[model samples]
Target: MADDTEANRERGIFIMIYLDYAAHTPVCDEVLKSFEEAARDFTGNPNSPHTPGVMAKKRLEEATENIAKILSAKKEEIIYTSGASESNNLAIKGIAKSYQRYGKHIITSFLEHASVTGPVAALKNEGYEVDFVNINKDGSVDLEHLKELLRDDTILVSIACVDSEIGAIQPIDKIYELVKTKPHCFFHVDATQAVGKIPVSFQNMDLMTLSGHKIYGITGIGVLLKKEQIMLEPLIHGGLSTTSFRSGTPALALCVSLESALAYTTGHLEEFYDKVREKNLLLRRALEKNKNIVINTPEDGSPFILNLSLKGVNTNALQAALDEKGICVATKSACCAVNTVSKPVYAMTKDKKLSLATLRISLSHMTTAEEIERFLDVFLEAIKG
Candidate 1:
């Protein structure tokens, strides 16, 4: 019976439709090919002084230049890290430790990914005061409360450019303007979810984080965009190679892969968004036909993610049903999926039951209309059962 079950599971998975792009995306064919070719030729330490190392160093510099061009930033401002989580940690903890003399107050929203919250939580235990800005039902940050929370000692304000759970795009420009009143404060944005799907600007941002995996690049590689004047205490202590802030030998292949990923996405971003937007609309319309569901993502939110609650249904069971049907979705961040509840969704609705039933359906540019239609049929059947 177990052998039969395993075979059945494998068969079902073979036809699965992936709708979890916000969690992670497969590296594009172009990026993979570029990385494979570069890895074959550029296998040397970027920090080494040998001839082969010089070739690796050149590749690193070229990748940095390309990434900076995509982000509208200076090449020198980019500091590579393992991924966005580390970048968030380095940005938040580094600033808290280095700039606390200026002020010990830090502010962030409840909708932030765990990476930001984990570092902020650690600082609270060390005597730094943290204010968690609340969000409206639509998942947009409460600007009035954020303005009220600012103080002379508020040295850093970190906000996610887009909420990965619900795909709500925060008004960073306005937040940047309001934060300017504090004089000593610096603005940090986690653009992990928004980078490839939407436009991200560094106009008034002091620090920004990006993850390569989220944009169809290789895993274990990311970028931290820091303004030239902003100083941070080093998180990793070693010989400085990439930037004075992060110490380690750079992964030359990963850098080249990330550069390729960013260039491909940005080059076709508008066209990609249009296609995904249509798929999102189709999914939303199908869900609307079932009054047993409530859409949580705002209409103005990014079309890449659609969050909804299945009334009178258990989310764990729903997830299992979807899995058996070879459909992939998420209840929250894949990082926090082990927990039974979604803190971010609960923070937005303040309704435990609604949060418990929430499902995140994320789309990619490659999503097809047939996949959305099939998902709707299976979803309605599962709810009825």
Candidate 2:
């Protein structure tokens, strides 16, 4: 794929129109500038006690404060990590170990990303009882099922705020209300697909996960927002750092870029939402006309992602066909194993064949009408028998 893309660039004809924004976003110039500026200006370890070190620590603190202010959390509540995957792990595993004496039960749904599911699976192998909350036909968490699943022994309920593959928005507020009834239970939300695209409040969560690349910031930086009262077993326990929950040298540049990207995204969320809605609508109108295509994303799902399945058609072949036309998308989550059915789609549609043939076309505020039209043209051609 890399070689083909490079060859295409060398030929200097078609520039790829990317529609995989759910998996990753291109770092914007402004965010990249912030990263470069931070690297140059803060040339000392935040943990160091000297003059340059103090300056670096101050800058990183300011960045944390900025992000906390956006999340409606205190500065001390934010713990930086490698990315959302680590945050998910820390939340699931850390909470499992820290509070296991109270209870050893965990609840999650099939709609979660690989990162969330991976940790939960690991816990199950370690003698912790794990339960999966049923998802509704729309792919959102089934509240009644979740209610039945929660128990006094349920120490944690981890769920994604939004389904990555099909974009189903979970009712976080209601879920919080349910989780809080259990005194020992902690609610962890993977908001990696939610924060920059829509409005979310950390006030209702015990632990929350989000990453930079999803919002056009530099990759490899993310945060785990922990309520100040919670105690987490440290994921990385080697050195002194911002929070004892994870210990590592801060990626100061990545932190700065994350703050910049988040600030810009939250500030213009409405505008971004409206723009992506129109693009999603365009894709929906065009694709729904094709008898071979079945839209998997619910009507009320996030407008940034539009998932559809090609009936009786091999999605991998379709993806390759679109690639030939210089367009980019995903068969599922970018990290998902290739040639496998989309779990989220199957949860929503309950159709194995449709799930097997699913394709994800994620949009962004940067996506233009021209790109959508071109993609539809190529897509229609590819699906032609």
Candidate 3:
């Protein structure tokens, strides 16, 4: 009876410790309030010509301007989309389709999220030549090889600002300088894992992708920042809307939520980052002493994510063990978690053993010191048992 009660306790009633912020974050209170208010007040279609529509349009424009200001971009540059996947698809495929006359070759890193990878692959199938940039053992982009890969015919170069698997922050500034050597080449960044958690600049970026859910906003909204000079072929075609590139009715509630989330995140970014950085350091210091664990995240990368490979411990089993104790972690991107294969870490390092044992522990400003402590205690016991 005592054992039964203990087992039930292990699997029940405990407050869950959510450590998967990179996968997606819960909508914060501020963003939720804005969404609720928008739903109640802005009920008209933004494109309609009636007074209610005009009011909705005004509010929508304000949200767009707010997001642009936070990112240091022009209001006209922001293109709203369903999420990062759509934004990535539009940016990659749109550029390839529109600029084929200038060039047919494109470049990207092997460490990109599947959203970026899938669109690039589709482009390859459509007869465009694609080049993948390799990463160093530490997961940083190989700048020398990238320099060699550039040519007069290279039309676009896409790289992730922050890699999701290993949390390696790419040197976008240096990459921008290199890609500029080819006058016709445009640069795009899949910044799903970078924005809000770290400082991002659009000075050198021709196109960049952002997702609202990743920043504690609604799940269905995303933003693509495109330079006014860059031309993109329309991915969706229908009735004319505010922009010709993507044709669809925009969700006003989602826009309001995304704008509010960004305002909250960027307004106190330094404070939020500093707190998470301290937690990251605490976790690293605690695990570094264990000879059986290998830490893969770069020391200078974003502090919100940590990657580890545990020797002699099955990663799938450990994840399950932690989940049973009301702690949530991940073995890969949430989108690819169920697959038995691990690609990103293995491709970056070519270490099969490390990849199979990989675990991703992501933090957020909402994470508490007590949660971290509890995680370490539960994790160590699971590994030992």
Best by TM-score: 2
User: Which ranges of candidate 2 are over 4 A from the true structure?
Assistant: 1-9
Q: Encode model 2's per-residue lDDT on 164-186: one tens digit a residue.
A: 89999999999999999998999
Better of 1 and 3 by TM-score: 1
lDDT of 1 by residue, 31-116 (tens): 99889988899878988899999889998899899899899999989999999999999999989988998999999987889999
Off by over 4 Å in 1: 1-13, 337-339
The lDDT of each candidate is 0.89, 0.91, 0.89
Reference-based lDDT, residue 145, model 2 = 89
Q: Write the per-residue lDDT of candidate 3 for residues 1-385, one digit (tens) a residue.
A: 1224346676774467899999989989999999999999987899999999999999999998888899999988988899999999999999999989989999998788889889899989989999988888777889999999999999999999998878989999999999999979999998899889899999989999999999999999998999999999878999656587888887889989999989988888999999999999999999999999988888988899999988888888899878877789998887775545556677676888888888999999889889999899989888986
Model 3 stretches astray by more than 4 angstroms: 1-12, 337-341
Which 10 residues in a row give candidate 2 its minimum summed lDDT? 1-10
- Give model 3 RMSD, 1 decimal: 2.2
**lDDT of predicted model 3:** 0.89
Q: How accurate is candidate 1 locally (lDDT)?
A: 0.89
Query: Which residue window of length 10 is worst by lDDT in model 3?
Result: 1-10
Clashing pairs in 3: none
